[model samples]
Structure formats: structure tokens, C-alpha cells
Target: MTAPTTPAAEALPHQGPAAGTTPLIIRVHGTPAGQGRVSFFGKGRAVHSNHKKLMPWRAAITDAARRELAYAFPADAARLVDGQPVPILLGAIAAEITVTVPKPKSAPKRLTSWPITRTSHDIDHHARAVLDALTHAQVWKDDAQVVEMTIRKVYPGEGIDALDRPGALIRIWPIPTEAVGR
Candidate 1:
């Protein structure tokens, strides 16, 4: 089957104590997949494999991130090292991610306001997949730079209108150096 089409990523102006900075926002379209357990194989050296669905999800996240980064910082788009695009954000980073899944058709019509408790995967697993992809996309130097993160999973209408279908919304900010210790 063909991969689902995702909307273009956006860089939204942040309005707060930090006025000039804009947060990188990415909307990934399609059913969000969790990072599956790594399976080990081979007798001598030991090999490992990831979940079948994880690669596609990660690719989607990476592509979206790259597109947004280039659009947000056009000057940086030309800066490449070893034929790879350099990461845009550095130092401590903050991320907020919302994964939205489709509302099941079998659900009772009366159960509209309740949280999704019967998801196929845990919230953290979904976070892992996205984070890893962001790292691969060179959105930041490394996932370790993410000092603050808020991630959640919800169904369609429970989240924003952009995510009315199954997908994820990722927002990333670079935390000021002064905010590290305190």
C-alpha cells in the first residue's frame, strides 16, 4: 500500500517571554505507529531488527522535520556537512507531541468524552518513534538534547483540527541556556 500524504510542516511564531523565537511544528498524517521492541537474531555476532511499521513512521517524521527546517531557516539550508544537512537546533530543547488516532467505528456513540484506553500501543512507544525520527532528520544534534518533553495520544476530535485524522503533531522549541539549572 502507498504511504499516506502528510501536510507540510509549519514554523509558528511563539508569543511568550521569548518573543522572537518560532517553534518548529510538524504534522504527520496517518495512523501513528509505536516503536516496537527490537528483536535479536543471529548466533555469532547477534543482529537486531526493528518493528516493520516503525521505519515508515520514522521516515514520515524525518521528512516533515527536514522540510520545515529548510523553510524556517533558508540560510541554514545551504550549510551541509559530509553531504548531510546540518541540524538546525542546538543546546537544550523542549518538545510537545500529540499523537492522534482514529476513532473506532465500533465504539458506542455515547462514549464520546472518554480517553482512549484501549490503544494498540503505549504513549511512550509513540514518543520514542517520533524522537528517533527527529534525531535522524537532524532537527537537533541529538535526542539527548531534549531536556523537556510533553507527549500524549488522543483520538481525532480530542486534539486540534489539523489532526482530525490519524497522525501526530510535533512542536519543538530551543530552551534558553539560562533555563537549564533553575
Candidate 2:
């Protein structure tokens, strides 16, 4: 069978975001994930095996985020569908991502908080994956729109819901143009 497609905007109402409003916020739910490695082949070709496996998983998250955005701002979604050039946000922008992983049983009792994670998986790699997914989800015109970003990967602290599970919390916002120095 073939994969399904995003419904056409014509079928949906034209409801985008307001001219001046709270910046869009999307929570991708679940442990923040990363991208797969690229394996090189002869003649400079490359392939990503993990990507094929992760496609569906990533698409699910993207689709869910898009749905939420559509529900929240139909006009905005339709504006994008109308082929309006994405007025790439100018000035500085910031993004914050918190990757919460379940604590392991092997942990010592002395630890009372989520410890910083040091892994081979680069934090930017995970952020790239998320940005790519969000771009596909139409969270924005492009990932380059983000100028400043802060990311963290750690086990959820005690009393935190993620302590029992794993998930990602992402925040994207635009900085006032006046706030920019350059």
C-alpha cells in the first residue's frame, strides 16, 4: 500500500495566524529523538538506513503538530496553502528543547535530579531532526528561521511526569526586532 497525503488546503478553511499574536507554540510530545547516521557508498553516494525506519515515527509527530496548528489557526494554514511567500522571520529568534528520558534503575539513590546526558548522539543532531520534522509539518517556512537555540537532554527530575516515561518539550519564539543588536 502507499502512504497517505496531507489533505489539500482548499478542502480546509483558510485560517492562518493573526498579524500580531502570541508566537506559535508546538509540543511534539515523547522523548526527543535524533537523526540517523549517513553511510557512504562507492562513488560518493550515501544512504541512511535509520531514516527509513524512522520516517513513519517522524511523520506521525509532524502530522500531529500540523493538526494542532491547523486547529488553532486555520487561516494561517490556508495562507501557507495559498502560496504566500513565507515572510521568513527577521531579527533574532530562540528555540528551547528539553529531551526527557526515563531514569534507569541502575542509578544511585543519592541522585535526586535529572543528570545531564553525555552521549555520542549530538544534541544538534536531535535538534536538526526535530527542525526538519517541524519544517515538514509547516511549523515555519524553514529551519533556518531559527537564529538562537538552547537544547538539553536529560532524565526527568523526581515528581516530573517524564520520570516514568520519556518525551521531548520544544519551544520556539521570535525575539523582538528591536531587541536584535545587529
The lDDT for every candidate, in the order shown, is 0.75, 0.60
User: How well is each residue in 136-181 modelled by candidate 1, as lDDT tens digits?
Assistant: 9889888999877888777776644337777889998887754433
For model 1, state the Cα shift of residue 110 in Å: 5.1
Indicate the worst ten consecutive residues by lDDT in candidate 1. 8-17
Put down candidate 2 lDDT per residue, 128-175, tens digits, no spaces: 777788777767777888777777766665533332346566666666
Query: How many backbone collisions does model 2 have?
Result: 11
lDDT of 2: 0.60
- The 10 consecutive residues of candidate 2 with the worst lDDT sum are 9-18
For model 1, the stretches where C-alpha displacement exceeds 4 angstroms are 1-17, 43-50, 113-118, 160-162
Q: TM-score for model 2?
A: 0.65
Q: Which runs of model 2 end up more than 4 angstroms from their true locations?
A: 1-21, 40-46, 80-92, 113-120, 158-164
| Best candidate according to TM-score | 1
